[model samples]
Target: MNGGDGPSSYARNSAYQRGAIEAAGALLREEIHKRLDLANHTRSSFTIADFGCSSGPNTLLAIDIIIQALLHKFSSSTADVKTPEFQVFLNDLSHSDFNALFALLPPQSQRPYFVAGVPGSFYGNLFPKASLNLAHSSCALNWLSDLPPELTDTTSPAHNRGRIFYTGASAEVAQAYSCQFKKDIKSFLVARSRELAEDGLMALIVPGVPDGFLDSQASTGSEFDLVGSCCWAII
Candidate 1:
């Protein structure tokens, strides 16, 4: 994701992604309320980690929704409930504009949680085992940790020349991308599994394609294809 809040920056260009998060807000709240095990939440603070949190208002919005849902859950409980402090870890690549993200935070007097920036790849462990109560990510899982090896190997059958992505590439090139995606996703799941507390809840807003759909059938594919075309034209 691009850094900063300029017109072309990710923060400004992310309404499409924001809509996906907004659409999933209800489901996220309901699932958290119904399934989060408060019995195991005996600690003084409850931890929530937002993986791939780009510079935002979207990340802030998502966190606010989760906190509100938890607060409502506590208020509705029949037994006396002790609300714990909230700790939010906003994670993204190291180069993400943390300063801009912090600038978007609610004022210190009004903010409900102790928020911190976590910088690193999500494919590796970022926190201690069993530390997170809620793990959340939106519209971010599709990113591969690295490009497929063969995409850069001119001699390989899967080499992806004249294109920046596999959208209209050959089957072998597409297969290479597919294999890399699987590996990256598996690593993500494993790392998150290790970080989440027992009975912890995970909320993800992942984009997907129908079984028979081609890459160009999706909006993102079309956008990338356009970018690639422009790049080739300049070259």
Candidate 2:
């Protein structure tokens, strides 16, 4: 992802991602209201982690939605409840533009939560065991932790000589990418499971090709392939 709020930056180009998160707002609120175990949560603070929270206003928007849903949950409850202070972990790759992300945050006086940046891949352990009350990730899980080793090994059948991505590549190349995705996703789930408190809710807005769907038919795949082609040309 491009850093900063420049014309080509992710912060500027991520309206589609923002729209997806916005469209899911109603369902997210409903799930939080129904499934969030507030009764047993005696903690003074509510911890929320956003995995793959790239530089931006989109991450902020997603956090606001989650916070609003939680507020509504407490407000509508028949039992009197004191709202807990929110602690949000904005996670992304180490090289992500943290400065740009922090710059976009609401001022200290207006902000509702204590924000912190957690820089690392979400495919591994990020938080301590059972620390988070809610874990949310939007339009980020599709990224594999790393490329499949076989894709670069000359002797491997999966060696992708002319392409950088699996789309439009050979079956072996595609399979390698698929396998890596599965492995990364499994690792992500395991790590999150360990970090989330019992009864914690996870909201994921992952975009991917459906089963039986052709990658060639997907705009995202096409876009990546095009980018890969450009990179290949440079090489």
Candidate 3:
């Protein structure tokens, strides 16, 4: 979901998404140009969806970059239309504070893009089929839909007694998290695939760990990892 802090808290921690969006400038520009060209520069409007847009100005940055890219592509064109209206959807979970998001929106006088809020989980299809020209999300995929059950199943071999996460646990623990993650991501991909237009582009920013890195290297492994590690060491 699009949530971090009530307002500023989320924005302050969104440096990752912000940096990812900026780094994707070339890719975004290329896709925008391609879509514009495909429409023969005659389409009257463009639609974009920012899935999992948690609160704050960070969402603003990403969408602004996308809108700017479109404008740039059409700037030198001979398209009959001056500038097509941009429709941006800011999506998050049902509980996301869309009010806070709207409060931060730039006035129409300062920007041409029209904005709307979409409330729901992005793990499923949230838009109409072939309705979007672009879909974007960043720094939010690391979250799994649910904790791996085996980790807390006292009777299960993979039980991670006394710990809250999989880090520093046995291979079985990591495998559980991995398996659930795969399932969640596959569902996500399937939903988005059906929603995107034939020419639509999706841009995503996912956090990374080095190849060969183990659960021990989880960048922000929960505090339970320390206790779990000590328990393992004592055993």
Candidate 4:
């Protein structure tokens, strides 16, 4: 895990930073509520999954918040006539630590919920078709498996066209990296489409430049987009 060297290294190490992880979970909780409202399916069954959930205190913290938020919202009078049981899946690479997460469960909670761990890259399908009701991924997905090779070549004219924020590199290499990111994201979405149910909602928070300066095509490599597309395809 060389965090500074390239994409995989960064993905292995950066995905679990403390503050950013907590913030991401908080934002995801809010986004889940927002999406639920948007879908107008307030009282239906709810199942949530947190993708790329590396082992750590922050991951558990996020899960706690998400569960609490859902419990509060779904149990309210405005919700549907019957309370829905929640099945939460926690997903991450096989190497991720789960001992800590498993140890942190609260005792005897009112909300009827179950937790399962899914091992693999979030890039692939992790659930049954139309099984997930909500999905949240945070501080992840920016890490592509590899940097695009075209960016490494200094002679190409399109080099600079796809480059993102790394200014020290040749422009062509940057463009290649950008293109690779877009392609990767598209594939990610296609895979997620197989698992998300109709009207399912997902919230994703990733690192990016403010003011939308980051290339839209580059940033589009996202778990949120993939899950959303999956939901759309079902409809």
Each prediction's Cα lDDT score? 0.89, 0.90, 0.78, 0.64
Compute the lDDT of residue 118 as modeled in candidate 1.
Answer: 99
Per-residue lDDT of 162-221 in model 1, one digit per residue for the tens? 688888889999899899989999999999999999978899888888898988787778
Error of 4 at 108 (Å): 6.6
As a TM-score, model 3 comes out at 0.83
Residue ranges of candidate 1 with Cα displaced over 4 Å: none
The residue ranges of model 2 lying beyond 4 angstroms of the native Cα positions read none
lDDT of 4 at 48: 85
Query: TM-scores across all candidates?
Result: 0.97, 0.96, 0.83, 0.67
lDDT score, residue 186, model 4? 79
> Which run of 10 residues does model 1 get worst, by summed lDDT?
73-82
Q: What is the lDDT of residue 88 in candidate 2?
A: 95
- Residues 139-193, model 3: lDDT tens digits: 7777787888888899987887767677767888778888988998998889889
Give the C-alpha miss distance for residue 197 in model 4, angstroms: 1.6
lDDT, candidate 2, 26-114, per-residue tens: 99989999988777878889999999999979989999999999988877877656888999999999999999999988888998899
Q: For model 1, what is the C-alpha lDDT against the true structure?
A: 0.89
TM-score, structure 1 vs. true: 0.97
User: Per-residue CA lDDT of candidate 4, range 129-183, in tens?
Assistant: 9888777776667778566555444565544433333444445555666687788
Q: Quick one: ranking by lDDT, best first?
A: 2, 1, 3, 4
